[model samples]
Target: MKLDFTLKRFPINGRLKEQSGLPFSCVLQPYHRLPEKETSAGDASGTRSNSIARCAQCYSYINCYCVFDTAGWVCSLCNRHNALKPQQQKRYRLDPTVLQELPEVRSEVFETLAEDPIPVPMPALEGSPAAQQDPGYVSGPAPVVVALVDTAAGEEFLELVRSSLEAALEALPPVTRFALITMSNRLGLHDVRASEPSVRYVSLLEPQLRPGASAAAAAASSPAVACPLSDVMPLSSLLAPVGSFKGAITRALEENMVPEQGFGETSDAEASGSGAAVGPSGAPGQEAAMSRNSGGDAAPGGGVGARSGRSGGGHLPAARGLGPALVAVLDYLKVLQSPAFASVKTPDSEGGLSGHGSGASAAAVVGADHLSQNPSPVKLLLFLAGVPDFGVGRLV
Candidate 1:
C-alpha cells in the first residue's frame, strides 16, 4: 500500500539568538487497511526524478523528502530525545496539521516476562475454597498481577496504551489481576473496577519525570510498588501508586533468603560472587534487574504488585543507565508477545512489512522513536513520552 507522508516542525527550546527545534518527519507506512502496490525503488540520486527533497522545519537534516507514491522517511537529527528548542526567529514554525490537510490527503486515524514462583497465600486465604479443590485443600497460589507503568504518556496515549494492553490480555487464558499505571513524575492510574473505568490523576511523589524535570528527579520519585500505577487514592478507590516499583518488589522478596551450603569454597565463592552489585545494572544485553530501582525484588507477595511510599523533591539526574529500562521492556515484551498475551494479529503474519502491515502493533508506532539509535529495546521509550506530533514524512 502506498501510505501518505508529511512533515511537521516542532518548536525547540532555545536561548537568545540560538535556534533549536525537533522536526518529526513522518510517513504512514503501508498497513492492511491501505491499498497495496509495488513501490518503484529510488533511482541513483536516492529519490525518484519526480520526487524532491525539502528541509523539514524542525529537523536539521536535508534528507527529508516528499515522494510521489510511498511511505515517508524523516532524518534522525530532528526527532531525537535530546532535540533542542527552536530560536525566536524560527518560533512561528508551520503546524504539522496544516501540511497534512493538503489537497490529496485522505483523512485517516490510527493508533513480558515470567519469573520463578514463591509459595504465598492471598489475603482472602480462608474462603470456601474452590469448586474443584481437594476435600481439605488449604489454599492455591494467588494469581500474579502484571501492572505496566508507561512513563510520560499523555491522556490519549495512555488510554490507547491501556486499550492495547487490554486487547493483548484478552487472548490469555485467565489472569487473576491486571492493572495499568501512567507516570511522569506525577501519576495517573485508572480505576480497574469503576463503572466507567477511567484514568485517575494522582500526585506523583516525584516531579522529575515531568517534561521539564531532570531525569534524577524522576528516578527518585518513581514508586517502589507495582500496584496502582500512580499516587491517586482518596480521589478514587482504585489508586495508582507511584515510586520505585521494581525496588519494592525486590526489597520485599529479599527479606526471605536461603543460605547456601556448598561442599567447597569454590561453589560458595561462585554463589557469593553472583549476588554482589557489580558495576551498573540493566544494560540491554546485560542480564541485570528488569528495573533500575529494583534489582533485589523480582518476586514478592502473590506477584500482584504492591506498594510503599514517601514523598521527595527534584528530578533524578539523568542516570547513565539504560540497561535496566531495556531489560524491563524486553521482559515485558516477552509476556506481551507471548501466546497468552497475543490479541492483535501481527503485521508480518498478514503479509505487510515484517510485523506491522495492519500496522496495528504498538512497536510500529514506538519504533519511530528509537529504531535509528540501535535496533534494540532502547527505542521503546521514545514513544513512552507520548506527545502528539505529526504521524511520522515530507514537510511540503
Candidate 2:
C-alpha cells in the first residue's frame, strides 16, 4: 500500500464533510513529514482537533463549511442538526467565527488522530456479562442501576434484599433502568431489562486446564471475545426510569436470583447435587461460566444462599466475587456518566447527560443546597454481608 502521499496543506479554504471528492487522504496525512521547526506533537499545526466539535449524528469532524447557531450546529455531511455540548456553547458565546479557528475548519481537509493524547485503554475483563448479548444495549444513553447482591446470604438476608429493593422501587421514580448481580461462587447478573426474568452466571474461579491444550491455546479458546465495557450492553437497553422497571425488578429477585450452592467448604456430595440441579452457561475459553439455578437454598434453616456450617474459618463466603463485581458496577455507572456516550434528558433539562436518574434529579433540586456542597454524581449503595473471596480481590 502507498502509505505516504501528498498531504493537504492546512489554512486553505472552503470545505465540508460532504465534499467526498476532496482528497481526505491528503488532509488526513497533512504532509510527508513533520516540519523541522516542530518541537513536539503538542506543538504541531492542526493538532488542536481534540477540542474541535463533531456532528453527533454523522460523527463527522466539524469543518468550516458547517453552519453553527446558538442552539446547534448543522452537520456538513448528513445535514443533521446536533446540539452543542456545554463547552462548545461557550465558543458560540464568544464568537461563531472562533469555531473556524480549529485546524480542520481552516484546512479544508480531514483531520487525523496521528497526534493527541490517546486515552489509555481499559483492561479486558471477560466476554461481557449477559447484558451484551442483546443488540440494542447502548442504542443511546440512559440512567442505570446496578444491584449488587450477596448470594451467599441466607433467607433472612435475601428477604432483606427483596424488601429493600422493593422499597427502593417504591421510592424510585419511573424509568426502565436496573441490573441485579448475585455474587457467590460466580457472579450472577440478572437480565432485568426484559419482562421474563433470567440471570447470567459467571464463575470467578480460574478455568481448569483442558487436557492436551497449551496454556496459550486455552486462553485463546475462550468462547466470548473480550470487548470494552461500553459495548457489553446497549445503553438504551441498560437505562430507563424506575417506574417502568418496578415489576420486572421485583420478579427478577423472586424468580431468578439465587446463591451458588458450592461456595466455600461444602461437602462433595452437596456440590455434586447442586451442580446437577442448576444449569451453567458453560461458555468455553472464559474463566466465568454462566449459571442459572432454580433450586431452593440448601443451607441449614433454609437461608437464601448461605451455607450454615462452612468448614472454613472465615464468616464470609469463599465464592463471592465481590471485588470484580464491584469493579463492573462502577464501570457501568462511569460509562453512563460519560458525556461522550450515555446522553440522557433530565426532567429539569431537555438535553444533556445524566449518570443517575433519581440522584441526578435530587442534585438538580437540593443536592447543592441541602445535600453536599460537592455532590457525587454516582452513589453506590452496595448490599453485602461479607467480603469477596473470588476473582480480582479475593480476601481468602
Candidate 3:
C-alpha cells in the first residue's frame, strides 16, 4: 500500500529528460479493498456509506492520505482544507466505538456510489423518428469491436478469424456492437445490420494517371484514393447490434471471405478452392476471369492487377490496404467519442465522482488517449492477418 518514488528529485514540469534518449517512466499500482459480505437481514447500513466525501477545491476523494479533524479534513494532493458535513463529522467522531466501527474513513480504498459528479443532459431531437417516442428514452453508448480482415489472408487465416468471431459471440455481452471490414486491393464494408448483409466496395487505386503510365503507377497511386471507411457506410449501420444480428454476421463472415486474387488464372483457381469467395457483388467464377483479364493488359482493368501484385511462382502477396482500413476505423471512433456526438446522459454521468476526483485521475493515468473526456465509453478491437504491404508502414 506504500508507493516509493525512485526519482530523488521530482520533475516539477512533469517532464523527465535523460541523455540516453529513452523516456523516464514509472509504474504505479494502487491498493484495492476486498468486498464485504451481506448480513442476514440484508440491511447493509453497518457497511461503508454509498456516498464519498471529496475536497471542494481539488475535488480529490477522501482517502487514508487525507488528514481528518473534528471540523474539517485536509486534502493531501492540493493541501486544501475541506469542511465536513454534520453527518461526516459524527461518522468520524473520536469515540472508540465509532472509530472501530467506521474503518472506511481510515481505509485507502472503499466502495461508493457508481455515478458521475456532474451530469450533462442530452440534446433533444426535434424531427427525428426517435423524437416522437418516449421523451425519457435515453440511449447510452455501446461497446464497439471492429474486425479488419485482410483479403490477402490465406484460407487458414480466414478460417481462424471465423472461428474466433464465433467464439466471441458467446463471450461478448449481448449489448456489444460488432463491425467487420476486409482489405486488399480494395476495402470492403459489410453492413451486417441489413436483412441480407453485403459488402460495399471502394477502390483503393488512385484516379489520376498519365495516358501511357506503367502498371507500377497503379500501385503508387492507390494509397491516395483510399477513402475513410465511415464514408462507405454510417457507423450506426456498420456497427450492428451483436444480440440481434449475431446469426447474420456469422453468415456474412462465412460467405464474404475474400482471398488473394489477381495473380493469374491458375492461382486464382487455387484461391477459390481454398474458400476465398469473390466479393459480395461479383459472381463465384468472375474473380478468376477478372484477374486474368486485368493481369495481361494494363489498359482494361490493369489497376486491379497492378494494385494487387501477381502471386507468381505460386507465392501469395502480403496483405494490402490494412493501413488505410485501420486509419479509417480510428478516425471514425475518434469522431464518435468526440464531445459533439456523445450527447446522451447515462446513469454513471449523473451519479459518479467529479471529473477531478480519484476516479478521473486513475482513468487519466491508465489510458488517457483511449479514454474520452466524455462519460460515454468507447472500445476498439483490431484483428490483423499479417503486416501491411501498401501504406506508410508497408514492409516493402
Candidate 4:
C-alpha cells in the first residue's frame, strides 16, 4: 500500500508531536478486498511452515520490502540482517524463474503456515481454568457482537431497535456470541443465558456515592468511579451463545420499555410539564403519572426518579446518560478485542459452567495472533435516538 503524508519528510523520530497545520493521520482498511480477489485467496505460493524468514529484532514477517542476498535477508522494518537457514539457502539457489514464482519474494502480501511435524497438544495450565474444561477448541476466533441500547429513548426508538436486532440476529452466523446492555439513568445488563433471563440493574450514580451519604457528597469527596464493564458481569455470563439464547435475547429487547420517569419523562407532555413545574427534583404530578403509566399502581419508592431530590440526581430532562454509557460499552469492546486481556482465563467455576474454558481462551489467543500478524479489523455500530447529555461530550 502507498503511504501519503502531509509532512514533506517522514517523521523518523518516534515521537509524534502535534503540528499546527499538518494533517498527520491516515485511515486504511486492509481487509477490504479488491473485486478480482474477493473469492480467491490471491496467490497460492505461500504455505504454512514451522520456519520462515523474519526480522530478528522486530520479528516482522519477510515480505517484498525485505532485501535478500546470498548470505541473508535484511528486514525492511528494522533494517536487521537475518541469516538464511540451510533449507532457505537451498531455496534461494533455485532458478530465477522459480524464485520469482514464490509469493513471499514477489507479492507485497502473502499467506504463511507454521511448519508442524506433529500437532502439539494444548497445555492445561492449572491457573487458567478456562483452558481446561472445553476440549473441542476451534482453530479460529468466532465473531462477537455487543448491543448497547438507550432505554431512555421513546417507544418508537425501542421498537426500531427490536427490529434492527432481529435483523442482525438473522444476518449473523450461528457461531457468533452476543451480549445486550441498556442504559437510561443507570446501566442494565441482560443475562440471556440465565435459567430465567432478567435485566440486572447497575446503579451508575450509587456506585460512585459514599454509603448513607448524598450524591453531592460523593461527587464532592471523590471523582466519578470508573466501573469496568467486566465487573458488571462475568465475561463468561455476559456473552451468550446466540443460537441457544435467541429467544431470551428477543424477550429482553421486547421488555425494554421506557422507564416511567427519569429520562423517559420527556416522552409524555404531562410528565414533562410536571417535571418542569417541580424543577429538577421531579414533581408530584410526574410521580403520579409514572404510577398511572404502570397500570395505575404506584411505583416503588426506589423506582425511577426516586433520587431526583439528590444533588446531580435529578431526571435528565433532555439528553440522557448517553455519553458515559457509550464510553463504558466502548471500553468493554476494547477489552474484548485485546488478545492479552481477552485470553486471560476465567475462574474454574465460571469456565466450567459456561463450558468454554480452555476453548474460549485458545480461540482468543488465536484471534489475537492473527490480528498481530495481520491488520486488525474492527467495526463499531452505535444505535442512538437522542443526544448525549451526561458526563463528557454533552451536547445539551
Q: List, residue by residue over 1-396, the lDDT tens digit for candidate 2.
A: 013335433223346433545554433343445443322322325445556677777778776567777677777667788887887666444364665454455444443455444232221222345222221222222334567788776657777888888887786534325566677655555545443334444444432358998755653453221232333333333343354455666776775554444443544332322222222222221112222342432211111223222223233334666755665556545544433422343475434323222222211222111111221244356788777655555567
Residue-level lDDT tens digits of model 1 in 1-396:
334435353344344214443333556555535322222221122323222222355533222222221123333344332222343113212445533433222223211112335443322221234311211111222132444343433335544554554454454323123334333333333333221223333332322257886665655555422333212231112211111122222221222111111211221232222332232222111111122244233321111211111111122311111223323323433332222211233355344332111122222222111111212111132224323211111011
Question: What TM-score, computed on C-alpha atoms, does each candidate reach?
Answer: 0.22, 0.41, 0.52, 0.51
**Alpha-carbon shift of residue 308 in model 4 (angstroms):** 17
Count of steric clashes across candidates, in order? 47, 22, 5, 9
Residue-wise C-alpha lDDT for candidate 3, range 99-218, written one tens digit per residue: 434444545444443554343234234335542322112334546677777767666777888898889887876656677877775666665544344555565543345678754574
Model 1 alpha-carbon miss at residue 331, Å:
19
**What does candidate 4 score in Cα RMSD to the true structure?**
11.6
Q: Give the winner by lDDT: 1 or 2.
A: 2
CA lDDT, candidate 3, residue 238: 64
Give the true-structure RMSD of model 2.
18.7
Candidate 1 deviates by what RMSD?
A: 22.6
Residues 108-201, candidate 4, lDDT per residue (tens digit)? Answer: 5555665644332332332356424332222235556778777666667778888999899888755456778777656666655443344444
Local distance difference test, per candidate?
Answer: 0.28, 0.47, 0.51, 0.51
Clashes of 2: 22
Give the clashing residue pairs of candidate 4, or none.
48-113, 49-113, 49-114, 49-115, 50-114, 50-115, 130-357, 130-358, 131-358
| Candidate 3 segments whose C-alpha is farther than 4 A from its true place | 1-50, 53-61, 67-102, 109-139, 204-225, 262-318, 338-376
Off by over 4 Å in 4: 1-43, 49-61, 69-101, 107-142, 205-232, 257-318, 330-380
